[model samples]
Target: MTRPLLDVRDLRVTFHIRREGDLPWTQPRELHAVGGVDFSLAPGETLGVVGESGCGKSTLARALIGLVPAEGQAEWIDGKDLIGLSPRQMMKYRNDIQMVFQDPLASLNPRMTVGQIIAEPLTTHHPGLKRAEVKERVKAMMEKVGLLPNQINRYPHEFSGGQCQRIGIARALIVEPKLIICDEPVSALDVSIQAQVINLLIRLQRELGLALIFIAHDLSVVKHISDRVMVLYLGRVMEIASSDDLYAAPQHPYTQALLSAVPVPDPAHDMAASVVPLAGDLPSPLAPPSGCVFRTRCPRATERCAAEVPVLSGAGHQTACHFPGPLTEAEIAFARRTEAA
Candidate 1:
């Protein structure tokens, strides 16, 4: 068994935000963004985090890299805790971890040339590198990510969306980071272009032995790339399992609902398919629903769900539910009665 490159436990993130009508002296309320999330990543492994918006997907990713202030253990491979590091302290790990943001154009600097954008990390992290060394390394990386070396002088706006993303990938890889947190990196590209970027990440991970935390709402894309998938709902994990297990037989009701929603290609199948549509809105994180955060929307939720929080408990296929397995329609109806009660 391989040791994890990064191990996270009971991770939580909160933001102090002021409401619109609040007075100046009124206390800022805590928006509970991430709540007691836990997972680990072996070196070179990809962990895909999927959930609807405001499920704390982005918050969890940023917390791992120390971009956002977080609490709880984010134990690195070397046993260093990544939880409470000051900005100065976290800088040491910046070279070892990097991020590729969701927006390709917005993430890159329009003012800086592509070469400078790629070289900036190397120059900042490894200050003693000679100008020629940085330039040569940038050129090598540019070629590696399928961008022509000559295009190094071009600004970000000069390139297409896909090309811009390639530039972003080059920038993240130039530092030779061990783990890269990709926050919906290809979401903005065309469907065909998304495939290209995904394949590029796959190839690079294999080549460099890099670990990845790929965050996106696209379950199909996540299934294609991830070794393990974690299902989050309003800051808490509903389930975690191998991509094969998750897609083949989802254990949690929330997970099953999500899987049911993925579009099937065949028109005949699409016509006959049944979606397990969840009934309620995503509960507010500012004041999350008590007990199981997902209970309100889960089709199989019951009295136990409201009274007691279900911890993730399983060997390989984990789920936070009292009845964690395949669900029947009758059971779903029973849950609805509980909701009405």
Candidate 2:
């Protein structure tokens, strides 16, 4: 087996938030944003992380690249433990790991020219690079990500939403990072634009031999780009498997419900689907239920589910649930038909 380029184990992120109607002396409440997430990525592999909003998908990504404080090991194959590094200490690994945010224009500095924005990482990480060298590399990267070399002098305001995203891609790739964390990179674009960006990332990953942690709520998009799929709920892993196995035979109730909700391409097929989509609001992370976080909303949930937290098990496929099995065909059909209220 090729050693994983990135191996994350029992990663957790927590935040202390002030109460809504705050009293100055009140102690902050603990918000368990990422309860415990574990996964690994080999060189050139893509791991798609899917979950509903506030399920800790974004928080997990942020924790991996050192954007937020994380507990547990994020061991890069080179032996660096990202969780222990300080801001200044982490600087050395910036080129090895990069991130592309969701909003294109919002991520860029409108005051800076495209060249300046893209070259910022290079300048910061490679301070010895001459101005001329930075410009040359930035222009080359622009060409790679479908941007124009001559447009380097243009500010972000001059570009469209899709173009601004291309600029973000160019910026992330400029340093030739080993891994790229794409946090809903396509969510802000048009469907057509989303396709273009997805394809661009696919090709770029192949060309650069880069690993990717693609985090998004869109199951179809995740299926398209990922070799493996991980399902998360309430800051914890629900199930994980190869994309084929995941879509065809999802074990966890949450994964099945999520896949059932993905729009079928054929109207006839959608009409034929009987699986009920999940219902009920995602429970607050601040005061999660005693055992499995998903029990409150799970149809098969029982007293055992409320008494014990299930552990993930398996070699090629893993699921964390008291039942530890896939939904029956009948249940899948019900899940397909039941839409969220």
Best by TM-score: 1
Give stretches of model 2 more than 4 Å off: 20-25, 270-273, 329-341
Candidate 2 local Cα displacement, residue 197, angstroms: 0.9
Clashing pairs in 1: none
lDDT of 2 by residue, 1-341 (tens): 98899988999998999968999899999999999888888889999999999999999999988888889898898878889798898998888899999999999998999999999999989999999999999999999999889999999999999999999999999999999999999999999999999999999999999999999989999999999999999999999899999999988888877776777777678534544556567889999998888988777788999999888888889989889666777765444445332
lDDT of each: 0.90, 0.89
Error at 215, model 2, angstroms: 0.8
Instruction: Quote the positional error of residue 17 for candidate 2 in Å.
Output: 1.5
Which model scores highest in lDDT?
A: 1
Q: Give the TM-score of candidate 2.
A: 0.95
Per-residue CA lDDT of model 1 for 1-341, tens digit only, reads 77899999999998999989999999899988999998988999999999999999999988888878988999899898988988788888899999999999999988999999999999999999999999999999999999999988999999999999999999999999999999999889999999999999999999999999999999999999999999999999999999999999999988987887899897778522356666768988988877898888777667988989999999889999888888798766655565456
RMSD of 2: 2.1
